[model samples]
Target: MGRPSDIPVWRHIGEAPCPPSGQERVTIAIVGAGPVGLAMALEFGRRGHQVLLLNRPDFISAGSKAICFSKRSLDIFDRLGVGDAIVEKGVSWNVGKVFWGDRPDPVYQFDMLPVKEQKRPGFLNIPQYHVEDILFDAASTLSSIDMRFGHEVTNVLPDDDGVDLEVRTSLNSYKVRADWVIACDGSRSPIRSMLGLEFEGRIFEDNFLIADIRMKGDHPSERWFWFDPPFNPGQSALMHKQPDDIWRLDFQLGWNIDRKAAVAPENVEPLVRAMLGPDVEFSREWYSIYTFQCRRIERFLHGHVIFAGDSAHLVSPFGARGCNGGFADIDNLGWKLDLILRGEAPASFLETYDEEAIVTADENIRNSTRSTDFITPKSETSRAFRDAVLELAQDFPFARPFVNSGRLSTAISYPDSGINTPDMDRWVGGVAPGSPVIDVPIGNRWLLDRLGNRFVVLADGWQGPAPDGVEIIDVGIAAETLQLIRRRFDFSPGAACLIRPDQYVAARWRTPTPALVSDALRRARGLA
Candidate 1:
């Protein structure tokens, strides 16, 4: 078979020099060059921290492994300086339609981004390799990042102070030391195995076949899912549009089927022809069979070493939680690690990353598990109930809520966390402490852009002096801006809210005072 014209060739870069034994110290060491690892390098390097990024393989990825990038992931990419490039290259959409049986029309449809005005779309579909390329280009320009391709970490030893890693290459073995080590080496992480960590969770019995085919067609750019369709017969399937006329098709194979035979062209081609008509022309770009699982480690933080992305947790692909959840891990850990390295916060602050990420992992696991259960019923009674809900959803509005093809991934809010200050003000319908702030327009700029990379005090009609490290933005002076702010923050004329560096609300007050604001700032930074 000839290679597709659209696929990019992987380039082989030469090996990097092995560091000396005695003087190989750095601030942070990141293992893997995938999206999550590159994100960690970019985030820490942007803040002027010395970062060593190591990758085992010398060549770039060939296929689109993960296609969906959520809005929260895009926002984090924006902060890392590659958001615009990614959005420009990817296909953006927020609508999804679900079909049951041989129906001529969709039984139900949903809009992910209900609000029209926002900084980013609900999600974008781009080849995972393209995202890694963009991140690699950005990381190359940062002087603080030391990128070492083809150097695999053979051993990781963590002590009370820091970690020591033994890296192996084609020519030589070297020692590297770092104050902190982040394991983003993916689901089959060598670092996790080297430390003898146990990842506890359940693996589903169902297997799925994923195929990426390239063709030119008139199909709309939205997610289309079918449950027990006529073309497949007693199986569920999903179809999604990609950027370069490449479409991703997923078919569920029962536990009894042979995985190798199912992915063979003789079998897969017939299914494709049946679904898209016999006359349609398409070429296979990539194909693979995978079993779904939901799992996470006991804790993300271990002494001087930490885990992020697939190294920390794994979820089924139904909710787009795998990559999106990894991005969330980077966002949660980056700022706190930066503060600790700079002595702005205590070392105990790192514990918050563990506490927060565990809760987030639990949330992702629960959602993914529920979606999987609905999609693949283990018992006859469960299957009947699911079918009934799908059948009724076509006509009744109440039944639409019960229809759970797959709950799309959204940002999870942390309302009751130890990091966020307790509410001391009256608010109705807006972001609370520990919740992410919804993006709103301020004049010609965005409210998030004005927040910058530091703590901020957002108030309406303020007449007092601001703190030293905090930026104060007065929103009540203009009618249009104030109205939008009020609607988004549920603010009155004199209300003020403290926002963290990652754009999460830390505290809110009906009346602003220097003492109270300072206390909130200190508590938010782990000074309390």
Candidate 2:
């Protein structure tokens, strides 16, 4: 019942401040202990930099916020040694079904996506807590990372040297200084607002209510998008399976209804009963009313104070990109901050964090917006077009992509991003300049499965030895895997590609050319 901050550190992962007697200075102070902040804290600590991770409420959120994670995000988590536990507990779902208005069954069930080759986990549907628990545990293992919860960041004052943060505990307040400060706060970020960064975007008129309920209904295990639930005349609903036999259902409640009244338990039950039928047993796990808003800060990093996750941008939860997008932010910013703090790379490397991340965040915002547009069309004419397309898509393969506008497998790429080769051909699949996630086999293993750690170059017909500092796996994969790579990746027999550490295509060539390969690796390392 006493101050939570008064608790000793070793007793628990308490938010008590490190005694101010030493006035300990650190390289970076990361604000917010959500997934993004925790990821950054781990990355910086791994680089041997002093880090202070601050968060409030002193606990992991119990509700499951995120619905899906991408293969690339899984790979990053693998490197950090946290993705394994999450992979074990969460369900792996690669397929999704799309339904039309009042349709008894889905018209299109998409199951085609390139699988990662490593024994590491592929796409997963673990709740946000599972990821946070792993990350929090990993952060605790690091002596360099001081995980402080219950420390409310009351102020962030930035300067040319570094930022000064005022963190208030129940006992007292402490002033902490660091060379860098990262704000991983959510959409209504105080740090971002203090910097005067404009969050530019509009909100969709439609509102929705989401409830996690246990239902033994007729729904498939895969992700489901009902274009128009019969009970909701002009709206849509998304229902998907989760761990522990729970199902997440999101229903559009229309703009005419009051946001406050729409989320009442009494108001929500009818929608669920109508969709799942009266015979099914149901119990609520959690519920929330949500509105679609798409916005991105103009810059991710302002001076020495940086931003990540919802602090940088806010995307609708339609594509399961909201939290995963923030995870990507940490993955990108982590290594860059590591390099800068270790003096391996100039702080200029940090600049690319803003450039590359903002681009990806903006793209995510746009993609989420597109999904919202499909879910809630603005005009009657647009609705008619969507209806017509849904009808046509019932039988046509070409119209399926139009009706299913969201591309879930789209990997994060920065073609003009200082990290990649400007001339690399992006036509082939796999994580190329413009490539989405595609299946490629390495020996008997899949290319995506085996791609972890350093950059990799999977060359089938190398006339010469592989380039220096590149892992050239010519025969590490099965012949079938190689054949799969050729068929799906469209690689020529002698084809070669330079994959970045993050598993994105840095450069590619029909043949293993030394100069291009070397330059691509160098660029990926940011030496260029």
Model 1 clash pairs are: none
List ranges where model 2 is wrong by over 4 Å: 1-14, 112-122, 216-219, 424-451, 456-480, 486-495, 510-516
Residue-level lDDT of model 1, residues 436-456, one tens digit each, is: 878877777777777765788
Per-prediction TM-score to the true structure, in the order listed: 0.96, 0.88
Span of 10 residues, lowest total lDDT, candidate 2: 1-10
Candidate 2 lDDT tens digits, 1-528? 123453223223445654565455678898887778888887777767889888865667666477687766776677677867778777777778887777877777775243444454346777777788888888888999988887878888888888888777778777888889999978888777767788888888777788889766655457777877686666788877777788888887887778777777788888888878756689887778777688888888788999899988888887777887888888778877776666656777778888888878878887888877777777899778878888888788787878754556345677678776765454545445523335455555555557654567767676545566566866325565556567555677777776655556667777657777877776666678
Q: Which candidate is the best by lDDT?
A: 1
Q: Note the clash tally of each candidate.
A: 0, 14
> What is the alpha-carbon lDDT for the whole of candidate 1?
0.87
